[model samples]
Target: MAARSGRRRAIRGWLGKACTVIAAAVLVSSVGAAAAPAAPIHAPVLRAPAGGYEELWVPSSMGPIKIQVQWAARGGGAALYVLDGLRAPNDHSQWTSDTDALRQFANDNVTLVFPVGGRSSFYTDWYRSSSTNRQPITYKWETFLTRELPDFLAGYGVSRTNKAIVGASMGGNAALVLAAHHRDQFRFAGSFSGFVNPTFPMWNQAMRAAMWDEGQFNVDDMWGPAGDPAWSRNDATAQAERLRGLPMYVSSGNGMPGPPDLPYGAVNTVNAMALEAMTMTAAQIFRDRVAALGIGARIEIGNGTHTWPYWRQGLANARPMILDALGAH
Candidate 1:
């Protein structure tokens, strides 16, 4: 009997140890659960003075998109979206850096909206991930610009419908595409030194080289193979009929240096000359297509290169048209 009692006490001792271990495990789990970090909360931070140049962090599916904005001088509702070239920087826009865009539009009674960062993206939605390199997320720029951005801007008294878009180089093509597709959003569209005819023979090759040079991005990842319908869809020349009744401005250089290239070195000037020549040819083709469709657009071809001075002048020339289209003084 005493032995039986001893065995029972031994089993109790084992049960007590097991319970203690289980209790310690539960305590540790509870402590760990309490110690876990919480999910981060994101909020938009505004920088710069009121009614002047301001930076806004807008939320999107890809991530937060930085938008540099110059508010209308007299509280006007009209806004102008200025897009950057192929090698757009992440922190700020080239428009603000290269030109006096902020001061030029400070009293224009039109808000200037510059979307920062889109290197080699062409500001379009991609078919898949970047083939040449790994991207953190699939680019959904079309949706962001057309839907998310406009929705956000509407809250700050900027009209979603009354807006103008202008771009230089790669951005110029994207502006035309966006205006052609979303006519209701834009009343005026301008392209300065853009390869508007992307589907042309050897044009895809040129684009592939440029994209690769800028960010090692694969052109195939943008809209699939060269013959894909997306290529034709994004081509401004191919979609010229859609731009009917829309006031538009198109300009390119004649491969020769004008006053702007005088300050640049020989190599820079030569490169600009070659690029401008190619873009001019494509712009001419696009102009012919628009004319054939009875679409009246302001086309300017002059002696200059693919440098920023000409583009800055182009913007200045188009400012009056933009204000008139948006009725923004």
Candidate 2:
């Protein structure tokens, strides 16, 4: 009888210890759940474009932005970010709408990232919410592209550590500014007909005029009144010394008629001529600054204007150089 009683007590003691262990595990799990980081923002694929390209809606601090990504065939290496011009459309990147970049890089081993929108905003973080052509504008592009987008991309096996960026016109300036500010992120940068100097006298007014022509935006709201440090901070020419060790390509046309501009009644030819003239001056200044800094860069002065064909040709010329920098072949 005594043996049976002792066995029952021993079983009860074992059960009590097991219960205590279970309670301790539950407490630790609750504490961990409370301390963990917030869940990542979900980015769903919006659609598959014609050339095996997938467009995704990426959540950002500004809002949900649409980005088209063409993954590399082998799915590894640095990514190339292609930015648009001053009159960037809200729907898609001009790299797709105007040029054959998607088709050209379809089989390459480096992912091509094209971010849409940011018309006349220069892809920079603005001072405050403002209006353009009576439409409310809120821009946080620098933060989104440099911070949020990369974090999101890292989830999909894309290496955020290595990147190359190229831009045309306003995007070109933005690319230089981004590379200068975030040197560890981008190793190669290119600019085609970009207005590299915004702080020069009367240059701010010219930019204001261009912005007004594009979207009737108030230039004062972009960076502040003329002579603001923001202008100098974002000027590619001003920051040339910072780009000394990086690989770069700078190209611009001489504001003349090229093969594509010689077409039948090309109305945009005159606009290209004038626009390229303005950008050419700034580009030359940028080239000289880069040279003064002893940076070895490929600078091309072509016999074309600020047309799509000229920019497309610039991209074609820069492709091998960019691939070489990214080790993409």
Candidate 3:
């Protein structure tokens, strides 16, 4: 009877200690909860551009992206989306910086939407599980450009559904892909010196090299392996059928020095020549494929290299066609 009484007392003492520990844990949790700080604000900010353009930071899954827009002269019923080249700067659009795009379109009755940044992203969605060659952030640009940005711009009197898309180089490639995939949103598409047929032999290697130069992004993370189906799926030549009946303009240079070429001894001109040569080959393949598909498109080949001057010329050449398609006065 004495042993049983001792055992009962020990059990009761252990239960008392367990309760004390539980109470201590509860107290700590309550204190910590009370001391927790409030979450930080992440609202999008808008700033007016010095050149009369309005800039807005659009919130997306990939965080807030900056968009520079020149509101329409006649006020908001149509829009033209002008995309950047391979080396897209984070500050402003090349259209505004390199050329007189804004001043030229100042009187045009269409909002010129320019998405800034995205150096080597090609403005498409990425599947990045590894960070060896690319960043770990999510790239849902296809969603941002097609849906999120349009939906947000609607509140600002911009017509969400009525729009035309144009791009140069990398942006050119993405513009066609986006237009082909989402035909309902874009009525006209233009590509100037863009590498359109990326699935061609040795093209993926070139792309990888360019990406490494720009941001060290992985080609595989972009759409998957070179042999992956996405390579062909993203190729505009492969999807030429979808672009049928869509008003399109395709332009590229022969990489030879012309009016817009830099001085003969300039190394940048030599580099431009080499780059545009590759672009011409790919663009020709795409143009031929589209022609074979019975898609009537305006294709222009000029004696120029891959420079901002040539791109500006191409945009000026395609402007009337784009405005006509959008019925913009």
Q: What is the C-alpha lDDT of each candidate?
A: 0.74, 0.70, 0.70
Q: For residues 1-329, could you state the per-residue lDDT of candidate 3 as single tens digits?
A: 00011111100000121112100000000000011212222221222332357667787888888877776776646889988866676666666666567766767778888897776778888776325653758677888999989887776767767889988888888888889999989999999888788888767776766665555677788888788888877788888888999999889999787765533235545656666777788788987897777889998887887766778889889899988988887
Query: Against the true structure, candidate 1 has what lDDT?
Result: 0.74
Per-residue alpha-carbon lDDT of candidate 2 for residues 140-166, written as tens digits (9 for 90 to 100): 888988998888777666667688999
lDDT of 2 at 64: 80
> Who is ahead in lDDT, 1 or 3?
1
TM-score of every candidate relative to the true structure: 0.84, 0.83, 0.83
RMSD of 2: 23.4
Runs of candidate 2 exceeding 4 Å displacement: 1-52, 131-137
- Pick the lDDT winner: 1
> Which regions of candidate 3 fall more than 4 Å away from where they truly are?
1-51, 133-136, 263-265
Model 1 — TM-score against the truth?
Answer: 0.84
Look at candidate 3 and tell me the lDDT of residue 236: 80
Comparing 1 and 2 by lDDT, which wins?
A: 1
